[model samples]
Each structure stands twice: as C-alpha cells, then as structure tokens.
Target chain A: MEPTNERHLLEALASGDRRAAERLVDETYRQVFASLVRLTGGDTEAAADLTQETYRKAWKSLPSFRRRSQLTTWLYRIAYNTFLNSIRRPVLLQPIDEQQAVAIEDPDPDQAAKLQQRDVAERLRRAVIGLPEPLRFTISARFWGELAVEEIARQEQVTGAAIRKRLKLATSRLREALGEDAI
Target chain B: MTQPTDREVKSLLTEVEIPEPPADLAARIKSEIPADLSSGRFEGTDLEVFDAPRRSPSRGWLIAASLVVAVGGGLIALRQMDQFQTPAGALESGVVASEAAASDAVAPESVQYRSPVDQSLDDAELETVLVEEIQLNEPLETRSSMEAKPDDSRLQEKSTPGPDVTSADKVVVDEVTAGQAELDEVSADRDRSDRTRVDQKTVASQDLPSPATRKVERSEPAPSRGPQPKLETPSEQPQPEAPGEQQTRARQRADSTGAFEKRQAAQPPQAPATVESTAVAAPAPVRESARLEDGAADRSFAGARAGSALAGSALADSALAGSVLAGSYQQVRSALSEGRWPAPEAIRRAEIVLGFGFGGPEAESKQESASPADRFTILVDELVEILERRQATESELEHLLRRSRALATELDGQPAVEELVVWIEQIGALVESAEER
Candidate 1:
C-alpha cells in the first residue's frame, strides 16, 4: 500500500472509523497469515489464530503507534512477536508423505521433475524453519512474506546490514542442511 | 550432492508454497473489532472504571493549611532568634517591631501584646554595646589623624553625630561617612596628579619653540604608575598601591559619588604637587595597614579568577563531549538512510570494549592481537551495539575495517564478506569526509 493511503487509513482508524479497520484487515491479513503460516510450520489453523491475535494487539497499541516504520512492517513485527509468545517449543514441520501424496495427485507430464522440485522445496522449508529465531524471521520475511531488507530491518528495529548478515547466515546454514547439489 | 549457492538457496526458499488465509479469517477479525474502536478502550474492557476510592476535598485543604502553619511558625522562630543575636540583628528586629506596632495601632483588635518599654530599653543597651565595640576597635593612629586634619570638614561631619541620633545609628552613619572620606581623598589625589601632568606639559610646550617639538614631546608615552598615580613626597617616597588596595579604593569611589563631589566643592584648591605631597607625608601607618589588607584581597581575587577559568574550561569540555556524541549519532543516522557505513571514530570506546568482551587489564592487548575473524565479529557486534545505544568511536572501527578487508580478501567470492568490506569502505570514506570537514 502507498504510504499516503496508509497514513490516511491510520488517521481514520484513530478516529474510531470501523470501515477503516476493515480496510486495514483486508489489505494486510493475507501477507500476515502467510508469514504466520510459515512461522507455524504450515499449520493453517494456528496461523489463522495468530493472525487474529496480531490484529487485536495492533488495535490496542494503535494509539501509541509511532510512524517511524511502515504500517506493514509494524504489523509484521507484531505478528512475529505474537508467534514467538504463543509457541515456546521448536516448530514441527508437516510430514513429507502428505506433501508427496498431494504432488502425486497432480495430472501433469512433468510429474517427476515437479516431485523432485517439491522434495527440494520441502527440505528448504524445513531448513528455514530450523534456523535460529531472528534468522528465521529475516529469511521468512524476505522470501515468504516478500518484505524488503530495509523493511525487515525496520520491523526488527535493526540496521539493514544486520538483516542482510542474518540472511547470509541463514542461507549458509540452509546450504549446509541441504547438500551442495540440492538446488 | 553439492552445497547450494546463496542465490540458489534464496530462489528455493521463495519457491516454497505459502498457504492462503481462509476467506472467513478477515471477516472474523473485523467482527471481533468493535465499531466504536476509540483509543484506550475495547468493547468489554473500559479502563475508566476503577475500584479505588476517590480522595475527599477536605484532605487537600488540611494539607494546604498544615503547610501554611509550618511556614508561619518557622518565620516566627527566626524573628525571635534575631532579637538576641548581634546588635545589627537586634536593630533589625527593633525596626520590624516598630513597623508592626504602627500597623497594629491602625487595627487595634489584631494587637496581641504590648512591650514598648522593654523594646526601648533593649535598643538603648544595643546602642551602648555597639558604641563600646566601635571605640575599642578604632585605631589610635586613625583618631590622631582625624585630630591632626582638623581642616578636613568631611571627617568632622562623620565623627560628630546629631543629638537625635542613637549611638548605634551614629556608629553606622560614621562608618559610611569614613568610607566616603577615603574615596574623596583618593579622587583628590588622582585630580592633583592629572593637574601636575597638565602643568608639566604646559611648561614643556612654552619652553619649546617649534610646533613639531611640542607634538613630539606630547607623543612620548607617560611613565606607567599602574592604575592609580601616587603622589611622591621629598620627605618619604610614595609606596606602590597593592592590587587589593586599588580594588578597595575603586569600590569606595563607586559607593560615594555624591560625597566625592561635595568634598571636592568644600575643599580649597592648592598647587597639585605640594598638596598631594603634604597629604602623602601625613599618614605612614595607613599605607602599611592598606598593604596588609591588600595582600589577603589579592590572594582571594587570584583564587576567584583561577576558579572561574577552571569552570569555563569544564563547561567548554562538556560542550565538546556533547558535540562529539551528537556527531556520532548524526553519522550513524545519515549512513543508515543513505545505505552506507558511519565513521569509525564516531563510535564510542565503551561500545567497542563491551562488544569485544575486553573487560580486564589485558583487554587492550587481547583486542590488538585478536584474529581477523574475531575482529570482524567484534566489528559487527560493535556496529549493532552502536545502533542500540545510539552512539560509535575511531580506532576500533579502523581495526575492524582492516580485519574485515583482510578477511574479505581471504574469503574471496563470498557475497556476504564482499558486502561487509564495501560497507566498511563506505564508513572509511565517511570518516575521511568528516575529518576534511
């Protein structure tokens, strides 16, 4: 969303405009849910619950929202924090057989290549989920949620260089987890 | 299988499927949010409703009344103490009492007690005590000087008081008059010397034939006698005035401008050199006593000046330190926004110390001899700390940059290492630009 439009929406929301709240939910709920989906290791139900909690907390903290960062970055931070608070144990990825069964059902001539791609992608996702906290968030926000490094940094309240270092570290770890020829 | 490259890893990560949110999710969240949606309140949680009891207005009034009583009692006790202290304190108390009595006479109902007789008796005792103290402290030489300079009407006016004046009031008046007399004498000495110089110049001009000779004589610098010129007598050479004595004389002059002018009018004019010579020869002990007073005053003045200079330097140093901190913050902010690194020098020593875990006496040597990788780690840690603390320093940044560059070369073709090297170089450029500025 454009900054000016977001600013207007924020102003409207601050004035108790219910329509503005709905509009905000419409614009950001998908990206937030997607990020949460990855963070919860493909648990759609948990992601949905966390997304609701994230928006609820956002509303409560809306008045004190300093516009130092973009609204989306702020929401991403809230979502990330919400996920961290809710889940204490390591995330468990969905079993590979389920994904394999889904891939097997696809009626395409390139089934073998697609299946191999699906396996590699699943391994990559597990490697990403296994990565350390901030690294996981940095990589997930950058690729899964499609946030810019600068935006991720803003959300993390860190410099862009730090976020980039985290990405580099996360990727290096992922490379090690999955072998050299996996790509 | 071979390890994947960074670009390949990134591509694979992006290609992973992200599950879409259920269609009802947005509608459900919107339904949960209340229509009003005002700040500090939710539909069921009203922050304004509290169980704590409200304070009563009488408690506030009681607090205010107690404060007023406490202050009033303190002032009354202070006034009572003043009545039994020094004669000046007693006199001040007496004046206040008289004023209060006069006010009470207008409002008879407010008069609490009457003690006019005791007050008058106390005033009389303080006056006698003050007179005795003044007489006991007065030097025989000063008294003799006053007797010897009978023609000095200013001294006569000061020593003798009117019949209506109390002894304590007369002493206070005498002290003020004496200070005025001293100021007048100093001014008279100054005027005489000025006249002497003018008379000498007139004599020299009359003796010289050419206008050029007169101009040349006038252009010659006068002999420096410090701030105040002293009169030289043939009987006894004039003593140099001490800095303290000069300051005191200056203070006296400032205090009695009216008295100085009155004295100047009352006294008959005489030859500048002869009159000043007689005045200087008359008092020998006075100059000695003034010199003694001046010695203490000079020491105090010097001490005060030294203290003032120290305070000024401290203020300047604090200002400089604040500017340095501000400069570091600005550099970090500008670098972050502009996609570059900040100056290394602008980084603080504390952050470097904390970042490297260099706590002991050998921390410096450890930091100096740290491996390139360790140094790079320290550098990144320091940068993060700087961002956290909103502050940065130079030597650590330089060391970090050097190590990072060396490591980047050693780990060639690594994108992360290359990026870090470029960032450090940008910081180096920023430091260089700052230095130029």
Candidate 2:
C-alpha cells in the first residue's frame, strides 16, 4: 500500500492495536515469503522459516520504527539480515563456483531462440540473488516492491541517478557472470 | 549468442515468476498474534526479548548482594555443623553406619581413596552432600559405582555376567585396562629378556648371541599387540568418582598435600645446581631419566586432577595413578563442555618443536610421546579453538577434530556422548564452508 497507510499501520500496532497487527502480518506475509523464496533459490521450507522469522523480528522491532523510510523497506532490511544470519555464508547459486556457459545448438532458429531466452532468464535469477548486497537490495526492492527508481532512491536517501547506476552495475555483473547465457 | 543487453536482463527479471505463498501463511501469522490484549501476553507486537531494557546498576548490586548472602549462609551452616559434630560424635557415627547400610556402598577401590571424613559434618550430612553432588552431575558409571554397594545376590549376578557394563563404559574400561595390561606385558618382556641374558652369561661367559643370531631374532616379525579391542567387564577398572565431585576432591587434595609448594620448592634449589653442573660438565643420562620421571609424575597428577575435577568429589581426585586413566576421559568431557581449543600457534609450535607434524592427520605420523593423554588433550583443545573460529581452510584442524570425534565414538556409543558429538558436529558445520570441495 501507500506510505501513508503503512505509517498508519505502524502507528496502530505500536499502540497496542491487535487488529492492526493482524492486518500488517496479513498484508506483508505473502510478499515476504515470495521475496525469501527468490533469495533462498526456491527452497520452500527455508523460505517459510525465514518468512516467519522476519515477521517475528518485524513485530518485535515495530515499536522502534521511527518511519525514516517506508515500512516495507524497513521490514525488508530486517528480512535481509535474518536471511544473512540463517545462511551463515554467502549463497552460492552456481555449482562449484563455476558458472555454466550457455551451450546452444539447434537446427530450428525459433527453438534455439526459445532455449537461449530460458537460459538467460535462469541466469538472471541466479545473478540477482548473487549480486553484492547493495545492488541486490535495490533490485529486490524495485522488482518485488514494484517501486519506481525515484521511490527507491527517495527511500534509500540517494539520488535517482545513483539507483540507476547500481541497477546498471548489477546487470553488468549478471552479464559477466552469465556470459553467453545472458542472451 | 552474444552477451545479453541490459534490456533483455531487465525484461527477464520482470517476467520471472515469484512463487505464490501458501494459502495458510496469513492465517498462520495471524494466529501467532493474540486475539485480545487483555491477556497481556501479546500486548505489544514486537519482541522485547532481544531488545531487553539495559541492565540498571541496581541489578548488578543485587547480584553481588545475593552472592555475598549465599557465601555467608554457607559459612554459617558449616559452623553450625561443626558445633553439632563434637557433642554428637557417637550418634553421628551410628548414623553414618546406618546410612552406609541403607545404600549400596562404593566399590572397594573408592574405599582405598576415601579421604578422612571432616569431623564437622555428621554421617547424614556427608551422605547428603555426596549423594546430591553425585546425583546432580556425576557420570552414570560413577553414580552406579558410588551408590551400589552390591548385594551378595547382585554381586553373584555380576560375577556370572551378561555385559554388566554399558557398551560405552565397556569400551573406555577396556581401553584403560588394555593399556595397563600392555605396560605390564612390556615390563615383563624386558624382565624375561634380562633373565635370559643373565642365565646365558652363567652358561657361556663369552658366547654372546652372535651377530647372525641377533639378526635372525630382529628379522622375526613380532605379532602386533595393538590396543586390545577386547571389551572386558567394567569390573576390571572400577568406577571411582562422579565427574562433578572429582574437581572438588582434586582441589582439596592439592591443598592438603601442599602440591603447589612442592612444585615451587623442587625447581629453585635444583635450577642453579643443574645449570652449573650441566655447563661445567656433560649432563648425565641419569639426569635425563630423572627429568622424564618428573614429567611423568606431573602428567599423572594432571590426569588425576582432571578426573576429579569432573567427579565433584575429593575421594575420586586423590588417585595419583588411577587419575591418569580417569584424566583422559575427563579432559575430553571438559574440552567439549567449555569449547576450549588450543591456539593455532600452539599447534604449529608443537609440530615444529616435536620434529613431527603434531597437528597432521592422526594416521600420518606415529611419533610416540611419553604422555599420550597430555598430547590428546592438547590436540583436542587446539581443534576446538580452530573450529570455534569457523575458518574451514584449516584442513589440519579439521582432521584433528574428526580424529578426536572418531576416538570418542570408538570408546563410547554415539548416543552416550551425544552432547559432545552434537557440539562437534556444529563446529564441523561452522568450519565446513559451502566450498564445493
């Protein structure tokens, strides 16, 4: 929802409002779970556990929320940290620290194009998760939050140009890491 | 295909399917938050646990006061017991006799090591303390040995035996017993060889075993008497002290015997004399033997103290020789509990100093040490410290950890020392990075 509505929910929960607490969890659980599943590389159980943990941490830290940023961004930061602590090490998306170069050979042009696109998409997902923390956060917020570049910049207290630059750098890393797979 | 343009990557990201959460997810979350604030359980949405209010100075003061009160109360109780002991000595002795009869007495081994009973405490009081300490923290074998003054029927049953010892205890007991047996066998071998040599001298004064005869004997492969894998009855190495009582007893014995004083006194007077003698003349082999003997004695004391430290009794801690057996297992347990490991530097130093790779995989080198228990303890402490630091590339530390774990497991069932095993596994996880290797 809107930043104003989120702020209202935050206020309500902080003031001992049980209905508001339920509403907050209800609205955020799906998004948090979806975000976690992507971050965890589609491990459903880990996604669920991390989701619950994120919410539990969010609920506890709600009272301390000073509304310096959007409530969603605040919750995402908590989710990110919870994820990091649980994983204990950086998540290695590629097998054996070796990225698989896309190998394409097909007689049909259409079939080859389709296969290449599929490979590129898979590589992109892996790259997004594998991106350095700052860029990963920006990409996640932009895609999952569906927030505009300006909104992300505003929330992060950076200029719109910086957000664009981060997005550019992240895409380049993905291309480099994916190689020919980045079709 | 050429590298994908950023547009293609962006387009792909936009189309990427974000899995829909389970339907019950919202319901599950909602259920966690209480329906009403009246219960005061879910009054606030946030967790106060992690963000607990800062400790006020008052709390610190309160803790200090409580400690002081506890110490004072203990002193008062001790004094009162002392007062009562003198007037009711006869009655207390009668009570002690009855109490000993009520429970199965400790094994005869314990009787040999039992300390002089404090005149301040009655039999009942002493029993209460020993019983409480043993029951609370002593190992199973220790409790069994301490409490079970076996009835004649039970003794007879044990004599007839069907694995009277738990499998875990059986391995440890077997190991210690085998070690003793091996030492005895080696001594006997030397004695037999000496006797044959003497007899030969009498028979033929100049007819020594010739170079060919000696060569033949050397060529004959001796049968390997590796640590006897035989699981003997636990009766062979009787349980002496509970783990918790051992430490207390060790401290008491150290105080009584002025062990610390002896250690201090031993060094100073001999130090200047040894330096002067060694500098002026070549140090004799006798001095080396004396040094080795002293080292062995120190190890024996350390082992004994280690055993008693866990048993929580003075009775178990005084066994200078037996402690050597008890100390190895005790140190393992202590190392596990405390997460104590030797420093990385210490391990490296040992390797360099000893001239063999001390921290290498257990199978690689077979450098014999005068004190294997001390070496084992050092290795365990080092491995633990390394794992706790969570750097997986220390392959040497990893090997030591695995070896120690295997040693512990071989001596006991996995479940018997489950806690230590679990902790070790955690260390393994911490050290084993997501590196594909």
Candidate 3:
C-alpha cells in the first residue's frame, strides 16, 4: 500500500485497523528506530524498546491527529516523542567527567577485533549524543530520518526557514563535533 | 561515472536507505492499537468495576434451579394462604420490604457529608473572584512577603512527566538503573577482557562457543551500494537526490558527524546531566517568548502544584488549583495593567544568580536555564529593554529594531519571539496608520 493515498489505512488505524496499524509499524519502525538509535548514539536496546513503545503510542494517538501532516511525518514525530518520554525517567545520561568510556582499545590479538573497537561509525555516534539539545534534535531530524524542512517545521511548530537556519547551524556544530577534516 | 560531487551526494542522503524493521517489531506494534476512541472517558480516569468472585458453572445452575423452585413454592404457599387472608396486606408488606432494601442501597449517598472549607464562599463569591483574576495570572506569587511560594519540588515529575524532574533527580535515577552491580567471581574474570558485548552475545547467542572470549570485529561494510559508507569520511556518506537538496543533506550529515565527535574518545556517560544538556530543540524557528498550549500549560501548572507542590487535599480538588492559577494569573495581569515591567535586568539577574546558586544548564552554555516559557520572558524582557534604551520613534524603532532582529538571530530558536517579531513589525504598520490619522 502506497500509504500516500491510504486514507483508509489511517481510518482503519484510527478505528482499530490491525493490519493497517501493522502496515504502519512495518513501514516506519526501522526508520524511526534507526533515527532514534542514531540520535541516541547506538543505544540499540533502548532504541528497540522505544521503537515498540512509539507504535503503541502512535496507534492510540492516531485518532487525535487532525491530518496536520503526512502519516509518515506524524509517525516520525511519535518516535521522537516516545524516545523523549522513555528517557524522562531519572536514569538517563551520566555526567561527562564521571562516565568512564569503556576503553576503546583491546589488546586482543585479532586485527578485526582491534579495528572494531576503533570503528568510525560508533565513534561518530558518541559525538552526536554529546551535543546540547535543540541542536541535537535538529540534527537528528535532518540526517537520520531525512525529514523535509517544512515537515520538521510543522513537527516543531516553527517555520520552514527557521528549521533551515537551525539545520545550518546544527551542521556547523556537527562539523565542529566530527572534526574539521572529517567533514 | 566519476564520483558524484559532494552536493550531488548530499541530496541522496535524504533518501538514505532506512533498513527494514526487525521482523518481530511489526507484530509487536500491531498488537498495541485500541479501537475505542472516546478519550473524554479515559483521560484522567480508569474504569473501576466490581469483579464478583467467580462462581462455578454448577453453582450458577444450582442458584437458578433454587430460585425457580422457591418461586413455585412461594406461589403454592400464597395460593393456600390467600384463600382466607387479605391479599392486600401481603402485597403491602412485600412492598414495604422492597422499599427497605432500596433505602439500604441508597444509604451511602445520604450518609451525610461535611461541606469543604472552600464551600463556605459558595458560587457567588468564588466565581466573582475567578472572573476578575481571569485576566491577571497572580500578584501574591511575586510578593517578597510570600517568599516565592515553595514550588512542589515534585511538580515537574507530576506535570506531564517531562517538565517535572530536576537535573539531580535525573542523574541519581540514571546512576541507580545503569550502574553495574558486583559480579560473581567467574564473571569478574571477564573484566580483564578487552570487550564485554561478545560475552553478552555468547550468552544470548548460545550457538557460538566462547563468544564472550571472541574479540569484536571493527571494519566498515563493503561500499557496494548507496553513498559513502564509512563514518569519519563525510564524503563517503550517502547523499540525498537533487541539486537544491545540498544544503539540508550536508547539514544533516554534519549534525550526525558532530554527535559522534568526542573529545576524550570514550562514550559520553549515562546520566541525567548529559540527557538534559543534549535534549535537542526541534529544528525550527524559535522566538523570545514562552508559548504554550493553554490546556497543556494549565494541566501542567495544576500538575506543578500537586505532589509537585501541593497537599493531597488541595490537589484532590482541581478547583483549588484552578483558584490558585486564577488568583496568580490575575496578579500578573494587574501588574501589567498597572504598567509595571519588572526591571529588565531582574530576569537575567534572577537567572544568572539564582541559576548559579541553583545548578543551571551551566554558566556559559546556550541551553535555557528555565523551561522555554521562563526563557522567553527573558528574551521579551530584552526586547522591551532594547526598545527602552533606543528611545527611537516608531519608525526609528522599526529601524532600531535592527537590535531586536540581531538578538533574535543570536537566540535563533525562540518561536514565540519569532512570531512576535511579525506582530512587532505589524505594529509598524499600525504606527503608520496612526500617523496618517
């Protein structure tokens, strides 16, 4: 189903369409969870749990939506919102000084093992989660899910230009985070 | 074809291949939807029902049979006795017994109730005060004598959950949940090992022998399809399609890269401190005003008072919270009505000094110390202060609004002030209308 004209999907999802709801999950879960995992810097387990929870919330909240945006945008919004909700509990990120990063280097004899410890993608994830908010969220919205400027604007209740500007600043900050040469 | 230009590749990232969800996820998601939609009944209330302890099917049949037999017996008895006695007397007595049973059922409703303390004022007095205060948020709250009414420390927790918890609470909670406990002697031996995940995989992936002892492999996936596949090399990351898409795609990659960049090489710690600090605002225009959905705000405000700040009795009755909000909102409105703008510096001083005395985001960081509303007040105060300092004519202020614009640009994300900027500009139009008159 192209979900684009799947008004029935939405209606069914709204009126308790199990398959439509399943389709919604099948379509969006990977993107949503991957985006969240990226935003959260590879906390795979948390991302998985949050992904499931997002679907639950999205299903319950499907009726409340007044067709403000495409269902996909709404689903992404739900994912971000669920992630925010899950981390609301006290046990979240630790302070920089106190949190000792598990040493990246392993004295293991295998070359692959040593290389994986120094994996670039994983290192990049660490940098992303370290950024301050607003910037961090903006970056995630832009890169991970690749949401459009207007979609992000509507999700955040701001203008497209505003999101564009934030996206720009966020990029500059990302360059700074990733290192000048890395960009 | 030669590798596409950075701009070409940047565009493709937008259409980056988002992998399919793990198979079980769709099933899990499908199981969570509810068909019923009437939220008025569910929002703040859960269904309460009496589950009569289950009776066996045999017991049910036995009860039905007994009832039938008793009814037949009663009819027979009535037929025998009614031939001689007055049937009207029996009917009246039966009616009386039913009335007694009915009264027993209704007794709880009439058990007699004491009027609450606030009830003494009645509909007239309370509504009148609420009507007047509806315009002003509250005055008593600002009074020094009131001593900054102790906020229900837990209000943030109670109010929509997000705005309730403190930084310290967040940190402490994280520590409790994520901290490693003492391991057994056999497991402790693994601490000497370079990586731990292999052990978890070994335990979970029982097919692998000595998985815990196996070292992690760290090589990039083969760059077969899509854009650049490696991490540090931004050129390698997939780009979105189209020329105009360059700006957003590059911006997104830059952001993604920035998050992974770390100073010390180790992962950022798991704590509330980091989470709050990194709670990214949405990518949108921000203004220098604290805008909120009134309903959400009102709910949260009342929420702020409950265990967040109120006694159970006061919270049990929403009327009390509404009265408090009414009373305070009126005071703020009245003060504004009286043309009292608290010193512009007061907000900054309150934030800087109080924020330092209390732990804030940090002295230098750009993140807000208070919630968006409090931060917007600061920005609005700045706008007002900038206008005060310029002493420019409306046209001049419009020109001098260069200052407001500059500040707005610097703040970058205050949606309220950004919206107000349009209104402020519209005021320029209003000024021209006045000049025409």
Candidate 4:
C-alpha cells in the first residue's frame, strides 16, 4: 500500500498546529513503543525510550519531508536502528551474498529438541534475539511492523525467494521452541 | 520436539504482542522533536524518514578544491622565479643566450653552435671568460739571504746532480722565491681588497648591472679557518686558536656583494700570488695529531650516514611501544564491552598512552640509545598498565567467553571447519528467523 502524505503531516506540525501534531503523536506512539518493547523483549525502560524517540524523530524530521517512502516507514527504520543499537550486538545489517547463503546451514544438530522446553514467551524473545541478523530483520519487518512478505522483500532489497527461505527457517526454530504449547 | 509446521508457528509468532509503553512516552517524544526541528541542527527533516543518506561532498566542492590548489601552486612557482631575475640591459642578452643554451639542450634552437662544453656545476668547476691583452707588471722577491742559509741542507743531498737537474732545480727555486715574495706583498693587499669588495656590494645593490660585466670570481681565494662561515665560508679549516685548547679558529668570508663592479672598475683587481706554505711551525712531530684532523672531517660526513640508523631505532621504539599499548587497549575495550571494565574515559586515556607501547625490544634499544625519549615512554607505559589493571575491575569476561565457547563446542561437537561454518550459519538463520517474527 502507498504510504500516507507524511510531508503534509509534518508541515502542519511545523506551523504550530497542535491538533495536527497531537494527532500524529497519538497515532504513532502505540506502534512505536510496541515495536521497541517487542525488539527489546520486555525491557520497560527501553520500550519507553523507543516510543519517545520515534515520536521525537518524526516531529523533528516532519519539515523536510521529500515524500520518498511513507513517513511511517522512516519511523520504523529508526526504531529498528534504535533496537539494534540497544542490544549492542554485532552484525546487525549483514547482506546475504551468495557466499553467505551456503554457510547458513544449521550450526548445532542436537540443540533443537532441548530448546523446545523453555517458557514460550522468553524462549521466543531470546531465540529471535539470538538469531542471525538477516533472518531476524525479515521476521521483525513482517511482524511488529505489520508488513507483508512482499512489502518486506521490497523494503529489505532482497529477492522474494530469499525472504521466504528466511521465514521458513525462522518458523521452524520458533516451532522447536514453542512446540505443542504454541498452538 | 521438532521444527513446528509453518502455519502453526507463524500463527503463534503473530499472536505475540508488545504491551503499550507508559502514557508519558508520547509527551516526552513530542517535546524533544520540535526543539530538534526549530534549532536548525537538521538540514532536511522528513526526507531522512526513509533513510539517513550517507554524508558525502558534492562534485562542486571537489572542483572548487582542485581550482584552489592549481592557482596556489602556480603563484608559488612564479614567486620562486624572482631570485634568478634577469637584468634589463646587456645582462638580459647574456641571460637570453644562457637560457637559449639551456633550451638548446633539447635541440632545434637554430643557433650555430660550437662543441658544447658541459656547463653543469660540479664540486670543481670554473666559468668561461675573456681577458684583454695587457701585460702584468710584477717582480720576484725572497726572504732568506746567503749569510743565514745552511751550507749543505738535507734537501740538497736528495737533489739529482745531473747538468739538466741543476738547471731545473735552479728554475724551481727561483719561482718558489718569487711566488713567496709576491704572497708577502699581497698580505696587506688582502685586507684592502676585502674592504673594496664590501664597498662594491653597496654600489651593486643600488643600480642593476649588465650581464657583460666580468664575474672573475674565485670560489676559494682565501683558506678559511673559522667556525662562523660553514659552507658559505669559501675555504675553512680548523687552525688551533690556542696552543693547548681544543678551539680551532675557523674564519670564513664570502666575496662581498660589490665584487663585480670593483673588478670591472678602472683599477683592475690584482690576483693574489699562489703560495704553497710548507712552513707549518711545530714543536714536536706527532703523526696521530694530523690524522686527528682528517678523522674530524670524516666524522662530519659520518653524521649524515648515521641519520638513517638513528631514525630506524626511533621507529622500532615507537612500534614496540605501540603494540604494547594496543594489546592493553584491546584487553580494556573487550573488558568494557562485557561490562567487566568501567571508566570508559579512563580506559580511553590509558589506551591512548598505551598505544605508543611500553618497553619492548625497540623500546629497550631506544632506552640505551635515546634514554630521555625511552624514559618518558617507559613512565607512560607503566602509568597505563597500572591504570588498566585498576579500571578493569571484574575479570569474568574471559571466563564467560570460555564458557560460551565450551557450550558452543559441546552443543555442536566442533564439526569440521566448513561444516562448523555451515552450522553456525544455519543456527544464525534460525536465530534471525525467530527475531524477525
């Protein structure tokens, strides 16, 4: 779906239109904070941070809206960067070059069975957090951002085949973690 | 437990919901945004919404920079041309000829040329000049008379007694006596000529002279024996200022500026008679003392050769110090990353100091050779090491990594290199897949 007129929204806010700015703040706050919480995994301080930061960023950036992607897409990208930053891990945005694809076979043969027993919520969060960055990114774009696989493929600049492959692998891992409890 | 069916897994992951943040989050975000906006810190706003474009210079900036460099360089080259400025009158004709000769080196200057004498200035070179056909009025003089002379000198015994040898020896003796006498006459002339040269320099400065003016200059007319002149001194050698003191009075003087005008003036400048002075006053014969002077000159040249050795030693010291500091900083950074180390600034400071490295092999050599530099480095290294140890409070990072590695090894059984890589990749994909959902 085409993104809404983010530039129009920003221009209204810049001119001291409290109503317009308030409406933007109200609309974006829930999704932004939820996304942060989802990314940080129940870290309350971080969730609140991610929420405030998104709105702040949106407000500040509203005036220069060249209207490329929808304003919401930008906010999502910022939230993702913030989450990636907070985790303080490595390899957040690695691309799947051909050489990399061949290497992505399962690392451990035996751990899948045992990982199925952990608390579903915690396990899901940790597993996703521990997952390789590319797969993790694909799943997050689809879930918290509510983007379709096609939308994600377009956003991630990857082939539709690659997106599906990542999704299949991620789902299997989640299943191994959640098992019978999930359904 | 196995990999869940796609439909079931996707459904569960989709069901996973993030709770709403506190109400204050919206207010906080709202306030910070406007301040960032009106502050004019950001160039363009919502454009960054999609992506933060990498900061890079525009083509115009690069073009402007190139123009600046070109103009600046041209100006410098023009200014440097001023020192060898060609005079406006007859001097310009000679300068043009010289320039033509210079260009002639490349061929195609059409001037009828005689055999080209290589005019490149080496250590020993003299310029071309023409002299007028005037007779020099001079006479011979001598010092020792027949009364004080020894009847049979040791040098006389070594002389060949053939008829031709006697005639040749008499001619040589006569020339020697005449030359020595002329040098004596010019002893006072040396001082007077120097004053004239100085006066000429003052005159030359006022009006630019023609190129045709004779430049009958000698690179070395006077033997130098003073410390002041150095390369410009023309001729300098150490002469003992005092009998026992190490001080050698080395005096050097250049041809005073007005040398051209004075030589070209109505009174032609007199060339001093060449005198090979063999009468070195001495108390006792010391072969080593003469060698000592030669050795001093050798030492001056040796200083040039020794330059690289000294620089190499310094580089090695710096590298050694650098590695030591780098090792320490890396340890500290790893510590900081894991939260086992505190005080990032202090660690950063320590790293900066440590970066130069403590006393390694290079430092040790430097310690011996350049003690002051090495000592300063050593003190800083010691300080960094002390600070690093203190700031790196907890020591569990290594242990944690070991545990992580061990668990990783046990879980995966440390497959073959390629297999292990594949497994890591697959696990990575799984992990990433989970995160995405």
Judged by lDDT relative to the true structure, which candidate is superior, 3 or 4?
4
* DockQ-based CAPRI category assigned to the predicted complex of candidate 1: acceptable
For model 4, how does the per-residue alpha-carbon lDDT over B160-215 read when each residue is reduced to its tens digit?
Answer: 24434444445444543554453343323433443444344335423322222211
lDDT of 2 by residue, A1-183 (tens): 677888788677767788988788877777778767666656666778777767766665665676777766777777767776766644522233323333533467668766766566656766777788889888877875466787778778899999999988988887777774534
Question: How many clashing residue pairs appear in each of the predictions shown?
Answer: 13, 27, 54, 31
What class would a CAPRI assessor give candidate 3's docking? incorrect
The residue ranges of model 4 lying beyond 4 angstroms of the native Cα positions read A1-7, A11-20, A57-66, A89-118, A158-162, A176-183, B36-437
Ranking by lDDT: 1, 2, 4, 3
lDDT of 3 by residue, B1-437 (tens): 23334343234323333444466766665555454532312222111221136779999899999999999999988875652143223323332333334234432111111111111123444444332221111111121111111233322211222232344334433332222121111112222221232233225323322211221211112111112221121122232111112222221111211111111122234311231221112111010001111122223335334332222222223233223322332332222223343333332221121111110111232354453334434444444454334222565545534544443344342222333343234334334444567
DockQ list for all candidates: 0.33, 0.19, 0.12, 0.20
Name the top lDDT candidate: 1
**lDDT for residue B380 in candidate 3, whole number 0-100:** 45
lDDT of 2 by residue, B1-437 (tens): 67767887677677656777777777766766754432334434444643448999999999999999999999988875653334224223333343233223322211111112221233354334322222132222232233233333423332222222233334433433444443333333433433443343234313333333433432322211111122122223232112111212222222222122222233344223322211211112113322332333333334334542322222122223122322333343333333344343333221111111011112222354423333344554554455446454646645654665554334332112222333344344333433335
Candidate 1 residue-wise lDDT at A33: 93
lDDT of 1 by residue, A1-183 (tens): 899999999899888898998999999999899888866666788899889878877877888898888888888888887887776533422344776877776677668987788778767877877788889888888887778999888878899999999999999999998994354
Q: On a 0 to 1 DockQ scale, where is model 4?
A: 0.20
Q: What is the CAPRI rating of model 2's predicted complex? A: incorrect
Winner by lDDT between candidate 4 and candidate 2:
2
Lowest-sum lDDT 10-residue window in model 4 chain B: B129-138
User: What TM-score do all the candidates reach, one by one?
Assistant: 0.33, 0.33, 0.30, 0.34
